[model samples]
Target: MDRQAEFVLRTIEERDIRFVRLWFTDVLGTLKSVAVAPAELEGAFAEGIGFDGSAIEGFTRVYESDMLAKPDPSTFAILPWRSEGPGVARLFCDIQMPDGSPSYADPRFVLKRTLTKAADLGFTFYTHPEVEFYLFKGQPEAGEIPTPVDTYGYFDNTPHGMARDFRRQAITMLEQMGISVEFSHHEGGPGQQEIDLRYADA
Candidate 1:
């Protein structure tokens, strides 16, 4: 086994990780996941865990449903939210065909292919996402906008701002998983917030 794969195995045993979640995305860009016991990880890294691609939107037809999810050890991280009981870790997977070829339908494969092309042209792609969202009091009724949780504006720092506390918790969890947050603050609209993630290679 390679060094990274060996490291993952060692960590799982050392941390008493009971479940390892394999993450991937379907063609429509929706995240998908499957969990496996620790004992099955070695085999998963060697060969892959199989699943029915046909069940996933835009993946494949029922007649050719077999697909493999090969976990990428480099992306392994213990899920901070799943800290109770035996710990749960996660790894992003690369999708493959039954014969071990990279599946064209895999969104990760598409991104990697594009990145390779960009590299060949002496360019690199990076992304710094400024995620914005709204917080409402409750579900909105038909043709009615839900009430804002707070009437705060851009960078408003108040003692009772729920968004401030939410951002702190979010950034903490993100950092625990090795993701960096550049910064975050309230936005212009009421109950609107923005969080900027540090730029990273796409």
Candidate 2:
């Protein structure tokens, strides 16, 4: 174990954390999570908790269903939405085979493999995702396209703009999780919005 892992263990106790969720993405980039009681965290960090990989679309075949999720200490963050109560935290995990090998189907491992290749070639790469999204009034019914919150155009500013407030809140939450926000603005399309993340080393 490293200092960062030790620190996480200590912080969990000190904060009286009720649950710690281990998160990982599947091959198609869908996030998944499994919560562990704080008491089990140390063991989880050492020997990952098992899961049925076959059920997690794109993970493993039913014949070899067992999978392990080993939490990455550095990616730990307290979910801002869950911070006010019993305090739920989360950590990104690297999936592994039962034999302790990296699972090729894990999205994080795939990125690590690519980054390793880049490093070997004496090159460093950064990834920045500028996300453009629309703000709908509420959840849409099946097959129904929901209405936009407003008819704002690019860089439109109004005294009362729902998208503006949304951007502020989203950036605040992301910053609390130690993620950086480079920029945010309304897009050209009605209720469409965009937020750019700071480049992260690959």
List per-candidate RMSD values in Å. 2.1, 1.5
The best candidate in terms of lDDT: 1
Model 1, which residues run further than 4 Å from truth?
Answer: 138-146
For residue 98, give model 2's deviation from the true position in Å.
Answer: 0.6
Model 1 C-alpha RMSD vs. true structure (Å) is: 2.1
- Tens digits of per-residue lDDT for model 2, 76-190: 8888877576989999999999999999999888888998899999989898999899998989899998999999789887457678889899999999998899999889999
RMSD of 2: 1.5
Q: Which parts of model 2 have CA positions greater than 4 angstroms off?
A: 140-144
Worst 10 residues of 1 by lDDT: 158-167
lDDT of 1 by residue, 76-132 (tens): 999998757889999999999999999999999999999999999999999999989
TM-score of each: 0.92, 0.94
TM-score of 1: 0.92
Alpha carbon lDDT at 79, candidate 2: 86
